[model samples]
Target: MILKRLILIAIVVLFSCSHTVKGQAPDAVKKTFQAKYPEENDPDWHKDDHGYYEANFKIDGIKYRADFNADGTWVETETSIDEDDLPDAIKKVIKEKFDDEKITEVEKVESATKGLFYDVEFKRKGKNKDVEFRADGTILN
Candidate 1:
Protein backbone atom coordinates (compact mmCIF):
# COMPACT_ATOMS: atom_id res chain seq x y z
CA MET A 1 0.00 0.00 0.00
CA ILE A 2 2.80 2.46 0.86
CA LEU A 3 4.65 1.74 -2.39
CA LYS A 4 1.54 2.36 -4.46
CA ARG A 5 0.90 5.64 -2.61
CA LEU A 6 4.46 6.82 -3.22
CA ILE A 7 4.17 6.00 -6.91
CA LEU A 8 0.93 7.96 -7.15
CA ILE A 9 2.59 11.01 -5.52
CA ALA A 10 5.52 10.79 -7.90
CA ILE A 11 3.24 10.60 -10.91
CA VAL A 12 1.31 13.66 -9.76
CA VAL A 13 4.50 15.69 -9.24
CA LEU A 14 5.85 14.75 -12.66
CA PHE A 15 2.57 15.63 -14.36
CA SER A 16 2.49 19.06 -12.73
CA CYS A 17 6.07 19.82 -13.73
CA SER A 18 5.39 18.78 -17.32
CA HIS A 19 2.33 20.99 -17.45
CA THR A 20 4.36 23.98 -16.18
CA VAL A 21 6.95 23.43 -18.89
CA LYS A 22 4.32 23.17 -21.61
CA GLY A 23 2.41 26.21 -20.43
CA GLN A 24 5.21 28.68 -21.18
CA ALA A 25 3.93 31.58 -23.36
CA PRO A 26 5.04 33.12 -26.65
CA ASP A 27 6.48 36.13 -24.80
CA ALA A 28 9.11 33.96 -23.19
CA VAL A 29 10.14 32.86 -26.66
CA LYS A 30 10.21 36.47 -27.82
CA LYS A 31 12.38 37.45 -24.88
CA THR A 32 14.80 34.70 -25.79
CA PHE A 33 15.17 36.01 -29.35
CA GLN A 34 15.60 39.56 -28.11
CA ALA A 35 18.34 38.47 -25.73
CA LYS A 36 20.20 36.56 -28.42
CA TYR A 37 19.64 38.79 -31.46
CA PRO A 38 19.58 42.12 -29.69
CA GLU A 39 19.49 44.17 -32.90
CA GLU A 40 16.51 42.30 -34.39
CA ASN A 41 13.36 44.44 -34.72
CA ASP A 42 9.66 43.60 -34.54
CA PRO A 43 9.95 39.80 -34.67
CA ASP A 44 6.83 37.75 -35.37
CA TRP A 45 6.36 34.70 -33.17
CA HIS A 46 3.79 31.90 -33.02
CA LYS A 47 3.47 28.60 -31.23
CA ASP A 48 3.98 25.31 -32.98
CA ASP A 49 3.28 21.70 -31.96
CA HIS A 50 5.82 19.91 -29.74
CA GLY A 51 5.69 22.82 -27.30
CA TYR A 52 8.00 25.38 -28.89
CA TYR A 53 7.92 28.75 -30.70
CA GLU A 54 9.00 29.92 -34.15
CA ALA A 55 10.00 33.45 -35.07
CA ASN A 56 10.30 35.32 -38.38
CA PHE A 57 11.94 38.67 -38.91
CA LYS A 58 14.23 40.63 -41.17
CA ILE A 59 17.78 41.68 -40.56
CA ASP A 60 18.88 44.38 -43.03
CA GLY A 61 15.80 43.62 -45.13
CA ILE A 62 16.88 40.01 -45.54
CA LYS A 63 14.26 37.58 -44.23
CA TYR A 64 15.21 35.06 -41.55
CA ARG A 65 13.32 32.31 -39.74
CA ALA A 66 14.36 31.08 -36.31
CA ASP A 67 13.12 28.36 -33.96
CA PHE A 68 13.44 28.70 -30.22
CA ASN A 69 13.44 26.32 -27.27
CA ALA A 70 10.75 26.42 -24.61
CA ASP A 71 13.05 28.60 -22.53
CA GLY A 72 13.74 30.79 -25.63
CA THR A 73 17.23 30.19 -26.98
CA TRP A 74 17.60 29.89 -30.77
CA VAL A 75 17.59 26.39 -32.17
CA GLU A 76 18.41 27.25 -35.81
CA THR A 77 17.87 29.85 -38.53
CA GLU A 78 17.02 29.75 -42.24
CA THR A 79 18.02 32.93 -44.04
CA SER A 80 17.06 34.15 -47.50
CA ILE A 81 16.26 37.21 -49.57
CA ASP A 82 12.73 38.03 -50.67
CA GLU A 83 13.03 38.11 -54.43
CA ASP A 84 9.65 39.75 -54.89
CA ASP A 85 10.95 42.75 -53.01
CA LEU A 86 13.84 43.19 -55.45
CA PRO A 87 13.80 46.26 -57.62
CA ASP A 88 12.65 45.96 -61.27
CA ALA A 89 15.94 47.12 -62.73
CA ILE A 90 17.90 44.44 -60.97
CA LYS A 91 15.46 41.79 -62.09
CA LYS A 92 15.79 42.96 -65.70
CA VAL A 93 19.55 42.65 -65.57
CA ILE A 94 19.30 39.20 -64.08
CA LYS A 95 16.96 38.12 -66.89
CA GLU A 96 19.17 39.60 -69.63
CA LYS A 97 22.49 38.22 -68.41
CA PHE A 98 21.46 34.58 -68.25
CA ASP A 99 18.40 33.90 -70.41
CA ASP A 100 18.07 30.31 -69.19
CA GLU A 101 19.37 31.07 -65.72
CA LYS A 102 16.93 30.32 -62.93
CA ILE A 103 17.64 32.27 -59.81
CA THR A 104 18.37 29.86 -56.97
CA GLU A 105 19.27 32.39 -54.29
CA VAL A 106 19.27 36.14 -53.71
CA GLU A 107 20.79 38.15 -50.89
CA LYS A 108 21.11 41.88 -50.14
CA VAL A 109 24.14 43.05 -48.24
CA GLU A 110 25.86 46.31 -47.28
CA SER A 111 29.46 45.39 -46.64
CA ALA A 112 30.24 41.69 -46.82
CA THR A 113 29.42 41.35 -50.51
CA LYS A 114 30.21 45.03 -51.22
CA GLY A 115 27.36 47.60 -50.91
CA LEU A 116 23.60 46.95 -51.06
CA PHE A 117 23.74 44.51 -53.95
CA TYR A 118 21.84 41.37 -54.80
CA ASP A 119 23.98 38.25 -54.71
CA VAL A 120 22.11 36.19 -57.28
CA GLU A 121 23.04 32.55 -57.72
CA PHE A 122 21.82 30.93 -60.91
CA LYS A 123 22.72 28.34 -63.55
CA ARG A 124 22.86 29.11 -67.26
CA LYS A 125 24.46 27.49 -70.34
CA GLY A 126 25.59 24.69 -68.03
CA LYS A 127 27.58 27.29 -66.03
CA ASN A 128 26.71 29.04 -62.77
CA LYS A 129 26.98 32.77 -62.13
CA ASP A 130 26.82 33.67 -58.47
CA VAL A 131 26.70 37.29 -59.64
CA GLU A 132 26.12 40.40 -57.60
CA PHE A 133 23.86 43.13 -59.01
CA ARG A 134 23.08 46.54 -57.65
CA ALA A 135 19.54 47.59 -56.71
CA ASP A 136 19.31 48.79 -60.33
CA GLY A 137 20.63 45.49 -61.69
CA THR A 138 24.05 46.86 -62.60
CA ILE A 139 26.69 44.15 -62.08
CA LEU A 140 29.13 45.04 -59.34
CA ASN A 141 32.81 44.26 -58.99
Candidate 2:
Protein backbone atom coordinates (compact mmCIF):
# COMPACT_ATOMS: atom_id res chain seq x y z
CA MET A 1 0.00 0.00 0.00
CA ILE A 2 2.83 2.43 0.81
CA LEU A 3 4.58 1.71 -2.52
CA LYS A 4 1.41 2.35 -4.48
CA ARG A 5 0.79 5.60 -2.63
CA LEU A 6 4.35 6.80 -3.32
CA ILE A 7 4.07 5.98 -7.03
CA LEU A 8 0.79 7.90 -7.27
CA ILE A 9 2.35 10.92 -5.60
CA ALA A 10 5.34 10.84 -7.99
CA ILE A 11 3.05 10.71 -11.02
CA VAL A 12 1.01 13.64 -9.80
CA VAL A 13 4.11 15.74 -9.20
CA LEU A 14 5.55 14.99 -12.62
CA PHE A 15 2.36 15.91 -14.40
CA SER A 16 1.96 19.11 -12.42
CA CYS A 17 5.44 20.32 -13.36
CA SER A 18 5.10 19.59 -17.07
CA HIS A 19 4.50 22.47 -19.46
CA THR A 20 1.40 22.31 -21.57
CA VAL A 21 2.04 21.55 -25.25
CA LYS A 22 -0.57 24.09 -26.29
CA GLY A 23 2.07 26.81 -25.63
CA GLN A 24 3.01 29.27 -22.94
CA ALA A 25 0.79 32.15 -21.77
CA PRO A 26 -0.09 34.85 -24.30
CA ASP A 27 1.61 37.55 -22.27
CA ALA A 28 4.79 35.54 -22.10
CA VAL A 29 4.85 35.28 -25.86
CA LYS A 30 4.06 38.99 -26.21
CA LYS A 31 6.85 39.99 -23.84
CA THR A 32 9.24 37.85 -25.79
CA PHE A 33 8.18 39.48 -29.03
CA GLN A 34 8.49 42.94 -27.57
CA ALA A 35 11.97 42.20 -26.26
CA LYS A 36 13.14 40.90 -29.60
CA TYR A 37 11.33 43.43 -31.80
CA PRO A 38 10.81 46.48 -29.68
CA GLU A 39 9.27 48.38 -32.53
CA GLU A 40 6.51 45.89 -33.23
CA ASN A 41 3.34 45.00 -31.31
CA ASP A 42 0.24 42.77 -31.26
CA PRO A 43 1.71 39.84 -33.15
CA ASP A 44 -0.29 36.69 -33.70
CA TRP A 45 1.87 34.14 -31.94
CA HIS A 46 1.55 30.37 -32.27
CA LYS A 47 3.58 27.33 -31.35
CA ASP A 48 5.40 25.56 -34.11
CA ASP A 49 6.43 21.94 -34.40
CA HIS A 50 9.78 22.48 -32.69
CA GLY A 51 8.06 23.82 -29.55
CA TYR A 52 9.23 27.35 -30.30
CA TYR A 53 7.01 30.40 -30.89
CA GLU A 54 6.25 31.75 -34.33
CA ALA A 55 4.77 35.17 -35.15
CA ASN A 56 3.26 36.45 -38.38
CA PHE A 57 2.73 40.01 -39.56
CA LYS A 58 2.86 42.21 -42.61
CA ILE A 59 4.72 45.37 -43.53
CA ASP A 60 4.15 47.33 -46.70
CA GLY A 61 1.84 44.56 -47.85
CA ILE A 62 4.67 42.13 -47.54
CA LYS A 63 4.29 39.05 -45.38
CA TYR A 64 6.97 38.35 -42.80
CA ARG A 65 7.67 35.51 -40.41
CA ALA A 66 9.55 35.56 -37.12
CA ASP A 67 10.43 32.50 -35.10
CA PHE A 68 11.33 32.72 -31.42
CA ASN A 69 13.15 30.45 -29.06
CA ALA A 70 11.39 29.00 -26.03
CA ASP A 71 12.68 31.95 -24.06
CA GLY A 72 11.35 34.42 -26.70
CA THR A 73 14.57 35.38 -28.46
CA TRP A 74 14.41 35.69 -32.22
CA VAL A 75 15.50 32.54 -33.95
CA GLU A 76 15.02 33.60 -37.58
CA THR A 77 13.03 35.88 -39.84
CA GLU A 78 11.83 35.88 -43.45
CA THR A 79 10.63 38.90 -45.42
CA SER A 80 8.91 38.41 -48.73
CA ILE A 81 6.01 40.54 -49.89
CA ASP A 82 3.84 39.00 -52.55
CA GLU A 83 2.38 41.83 -54.54
CA ASP A 84 0.12 39.58 -56.52
CA ASP A 85 -1.60 38.40 -53.37
CA LEU A 86 -1.95 41.83 -51.71
CA PRO A 87 -3.97 44.76 -52.94
CA ASP A 88 -1.96 47.45 -54.63
CA ALA A 89 -3.34 50.31 -52.50
CA ILE A 90 -2.35 48.61 -49.24
CA LYS A 91 1.01 47.87 -50.71
CA LYS A 92 1.44 51.51 -51.62
CA VAL A 93 0.31 52.85 -48.26
CA ILE A 94 2.54 50.52 -46.29
CA LYS A 95 5.50 51.46 -48.43
CA GLU A 96 4.79 55.11 -47.81
CA LYS A 97 4.26 54.90 -44.03
CA PHE A 98 6.52 52.11 -42.84
CA ASP A 99 9.52 52.17 -45.11
CA ASP A 100 11.84 51.28 -42.27
CA GLU A 101 9.67 49.11 -40.06
CA LYS A 102 10.12 45.37 -40.50
CA ILE A 103 7.05 43.18 -40.95
CA THR A 104 7.16 40.40 -38.43
CA GLU A 105 3.82 38.57 -38.62
CA VAL A 106 0.50 38.32 -40.54
CA GLU A 107 -2.84 36.54 -40.32
CA LYS A 108 -5.62 36.24 -42.90
CA VAL A 109 -8.82 36.95 -41.07
CA GLU A 110 -11.99 35.47 -42.63
CA SER A 111 -14.55 37.32 -40.59
CA ALA A 112 -15.28 40.00 -43.19
CA THR A 113 -15.07 39.36 -46.88
CA LYS A 114 -14.89 42.89 -48.30
CA GLY A 115 -12.64 44.13 -45.51
CA LEU A 116 -10.34 41.16 -45.67
CA PHE A 117 -6.85 42.26 -44.80
CA TYR A 118 -3.60 41.08 -43.34
CA ASP A 119 -3.20 41.98 -39.68
CA VAL A 120 0.21 43.60 -40.06
CA GLU A 121 2.66 43.90 -37.19
CA PHE A 122 5.78 46.03 -37.25
CA LYS A 123 8.54 47.66 -35.25
CA ARG A 124 8.75 51.39 -35.83
CA LYS A 125 9.92 54.52 -34.03
CA GLY A 126 10.65 52.64 -30.82
CA LYS A 127 6.96 51.68 -30.40
CA ASN A 128 4.63 48.88 -31.46
CA LYS A 129 1.14 49.11 -32.92
CA ASP A 130 -1.31 46.76 -34.53
CA VAL A 131 -2.34 48.10 -37.92
CA GLU A 132 -5.34 46.59 -39.59
CA PHE A 133 -5.54 47.48 -43.26
CA ARG A 134 -8.02 46.40 -45.84
CA ALA A 135 -6.76 44.62 -48.90
CA ASP A 136 -7.33 47.98 -50.57
CA GLY A 137 -5.14 49.68 -47.93
CA THR A 138 -7.85 51.26 -45.84
CA ILE A 139 -6.80 51.38 -42.19
CA LEU A 140 -9.31 49.93 -39.75
CA ASN A 141 -9.50 50.62 -36.05
Candidate 3:
Protein backbone atom coordinates (compact mmCIF):
# COMPACT_ATOMS: atom_id res chain seq x y z
CA MET A 1 0.00 0.00 0.00
CA ILE A 2 2.79 2.37 0.90
CA LEU A 3 4.62 1.67 -2.38
CA LYS A 4 1.46 2.27 -4.40
CA ARG A 5 0.86 5.58 -2.62
CA LEU A 6 4.43 6.68 -3.32
CA ILE A 7 4.03 5.82 -6.99
CA LEU A 8 0.82 7.84 -7.21
CA ILE A 9 2.47 10.82 -5.57
CA ALA A 10 5.39 10.62 -7.98
CA ILE A 11 3.08 10.52 -10.97
CA VAL A 12 1.20 13.57 -9.72
CA VAL A 13 4.41 15.48 -9.14
CA LEU A 14 5.77 14.63 -12.55
CA PHE A 15 2.62 15.77 -14.32
CA SER A 16 2.47 19.00 -12.32
CA CYS A 17 6.08 19.74 -13.17
CA SER A 18 5.62 19.42 -16.93
CA HIS A 19 7.22 22.26 -18.93
CA THR A 20 4.19 23.12 -21.05
CA VAL A 21 1.50 25.04 -19.19
CA LYS A 22 -1.46 26.27 -21.17
CA GLY A 23 -2.40 29.97 -20.84
CA GLN A 24 0.21 30.51 -18.10
CA ALA A 25 2.56 32.62 -20.19
CA PRO A 26 3.53 36.06 -18.89
CA ASP A 27 1.73 39.17 -20.09
CA ALA A 28 4.79 40.53 -21.86
CA VAL A 29 5.22 37.33 -23.77
CA LYS A 30 1.58 37.27 -24.76
CA LYS A 31 1.66 40.89 -25.81
CA THR A 32 4.71 40.29 -27.95
CA PHE A 33 3.07 37.34 -29.56
CA GLN A 34 -0.08 39.35 -30.15
CA ALA A 35 1.80 42.16 -31.85
CA LYS A 36 3.60 39.74 -34.12
CA TYR A 37 0.56 37.59 -34.90
CA PRO A 38 -2.34 39.96 -34.68
CA GLU A 39 -4.77 37.53 -36.26
CA GLU A 40 -4.29 34.88 -33.62
CA ASN A 41 -6.52 35.64 -30.68
CA ASP A 42 -5.30 32.80 -28.54
CA PRO A 43 -2.19 30.69 -28.89
CA ASP A 44 -1.39 27.77 -26.66
CA TRP A 45 1.77 28.70 -24.76
CA HIS A 46 4.49 26.49 -23.32
CA LYS A 47 7.81 27.04 -21.62
CA ASP A 48 10.72 25.79 -23.69
CA ASP A 49 13.98 24.29 -22.48
CA HIS A 50 15.72 27.67 -22.73
CA GLY A 51 13.05 29.29 -20.51
CA TYR A 52 11.58 31.07 -23.52
CA TYR A 53 7.84 31.18 -24.15
CA GLU A 54 6.67 29.06 -27.09
CA ALA A 55 3.32 29.89 -28.67
CA ASN A 56 1.57 27.38 -30.90
CA PHE A 57 -0.89 28.93 -33.28
CA LYS A 58 -2.26 28.60 -36.79
CA ILE A 59 -2.24 31.16 -39.58
CA ASP A 60 -4.10 30.72 -42.84
CA GLY A 61 -4.68 27.07 -41.97
CA ILE A 62 -0.96 26.51 -41.44
CA LYS A 63 0.33 25.58 -38.00
CA TYR A 64 3.10 27.75 -36.55
CA ARG A 65 5.24 27.88 -33.46
CA ALA A 66 6.78 31.14 -32.30
CA ASP A 67 9.18 31.76 -29.46
CA PHE A 68 9.54 34.90 -27.36
CA ASN A 69 11.80 36.01 -24.57
CA ALA A 70 10.55 36.79 -21.08
CA ASP A 71 10.69 40.52 -21.76
CA GLY A 72 8.78 40.24 -25.05
CA THR A 73 11.60 39.93 -27.54
CA TRP A 74 10.81 37.81 -30.58
CA VAL A 75 13.23 34.95 -30.91
CA GLU A 76 12.13 32.66 -33.69
CA THR A 77 9.18 31.22 -35.59
CA GLU A 78 8.90 27.83 -37.29
CA THR A 79 6.25 26.23 -39.48
CA SER A 80 6.05 22.82 -41.03
CA ILE A 81 6.04 22.53 -44.80
CA ASP A 82 5.45 19.79 -47.33
CA GLU A 83 8.52 18.06 -48.73
CA ASP A 84 7.64 19.02 -52.29
CA ASP A 85 7.45 22.68 -51.30
CA LEU A 86 11.16 22.74 -50.45
CA PRO A 87 13.45 24.90 -52.55
CA ASP A 88 14.97 23.23 -55.60
CA ALA A 89 18.47 23.72 -54.23
CA ILE A 90 17.54 21.95 -51.02
CA LYS A 91 15.75 19.24 -52.96
CA LYS A 92 18.87 18.50 -55.00
CA VAL A 93 20.90 18.01 -51.85
CA ILE A 94 18.30 15.69 -50.36
CA LYS A 95 18.20 13.66 -53.53
CA GLU A 96 21.98 13.28 -53.64
CA LYS A 97 22.63 12.62 -49.94
CA PHE A 98 19.49 11.72 -47.98
CA ASP A 99 17.56 9.69 -50.55
CA ASP A 100 18.04 6.50 -48.58
CA GLU A 101 16.45 7.97 -45.44
CA LYS A 102 12.77 8.58 -45.16
CA ILE A 103 11.73 12.18 -44.73
CA THR A 104 9.80 12.38 -41.49
CA GLU A 105 9.21 16.13 -41.01
CA VAL A 106 10.26 19.46 -42.42
CA GLU A 107 10.12 22.98 -40.98
CA LYS A 108 10.98 26.45 -42.21
CA VAL A 109 12.72 28.24 -39.38
CA GLU A 110 13.24 31.98 -39.20
CA SER A 111 15.46 32.89 -36.29
CA ALA A 112 16.62 36.26 -35.03
CA THR A 113 20.18 34.96 -34.73
CA LYS A 114 20.36 32.37 -37.47
CA GLY A 115 18.30 34.04 -40.19
CA LEU A 116 16.21 31.76 -42.39
CA PHE A 117 16.81 28.02 -42.79
CA TYR A 118 15.08 24.73 -43.40
CA ASP A 119 15.07 21.91 -40.90
CA VAL A 120 14.57 18.46 -42.34
CA GLU A 121 14.09 15.43 -40.17
CA PHE A 122 15.02 12.01 -41.50
CA LYS A 123 14.50 8.51 -40.16
CA ARG A 124 16.87 5.69 -40.95
CA LYS A 125 17.25 2.28 -39.34
CA GLY A 126 14.95 3.31 -36.47
CA LYS A 127 16.95 6.47 -35.71
CA ASN A 128 15.87 10.03 -36.47
CA LYS A 129 18.22 12.82 -37.55
CA ASP A 130 17.61 16.54 -38.06
CA VAL A 131 19.58 18.63 -40.53
CA GLU A 132 19.43 22.37 -41.03
CA PHE A 133 19.97 23.85 -44.47
CA ARG A 134 19.88 27.25 -46.06
CA ALA A 135 17.60 28.00 -48.98
CA ASP A 136 20.59 27.95 -51.30
CA GLY A 137 21.33 24.37 -50.21
CA THR A 138 24.07 25.18 -47.74
CA ILE A 139 23.98 22.93 -44.70
CA LEU A 140 23.98 24.86 -41.45
CA ASN A 141 24.23 21.83 -39.20
Best by the lDDT measure: 3
Query: TM-score order of candidates, best first?
Result: 3, 1, 2
lDDT values for all models: 0.67, 0.65, 0.92
Model 1 collision count: 0
Which tens-of-lDDT digit does each residue in 92-131 have in candidate 1? 8767767676777776554322545667778557676688
Which regions of candidate 1 fall more than 4 Å away from where they truly are?
Answer: 1-37, 40-79, 124-127
Cα lDDT of model 2 by residue, 1-141, tens digit: 999999999999877654343334366666766776676665666666676677776655666667667655556665544444567787798899877778765555433133345667776576767687777788886
Instruction: Encode model 3's per-residue lDDT on 1-141: one tens digit a residue.
Output: 999999999999887666786798888888888888899988988888788899999989999999999898999999999999999999999999988879999999999999999999998676789999999999998
Error of 2 at 57 (Å): 19
Model 2 lowest lDDT segment of ten? 108-117
Q: How close is candidate 2 to the true structure, as a TM-score?
A: 0.37
Candidate 2: pairs in clash: 39-123, 40-122, 40-123, 56-105, 56-106, 57-105, 57-106
Error of 2 at 121 (Å): 0.7
RMSD of 1: 12.6
Whole-model alpha-carbon lDDT for candidate 2: 0.65
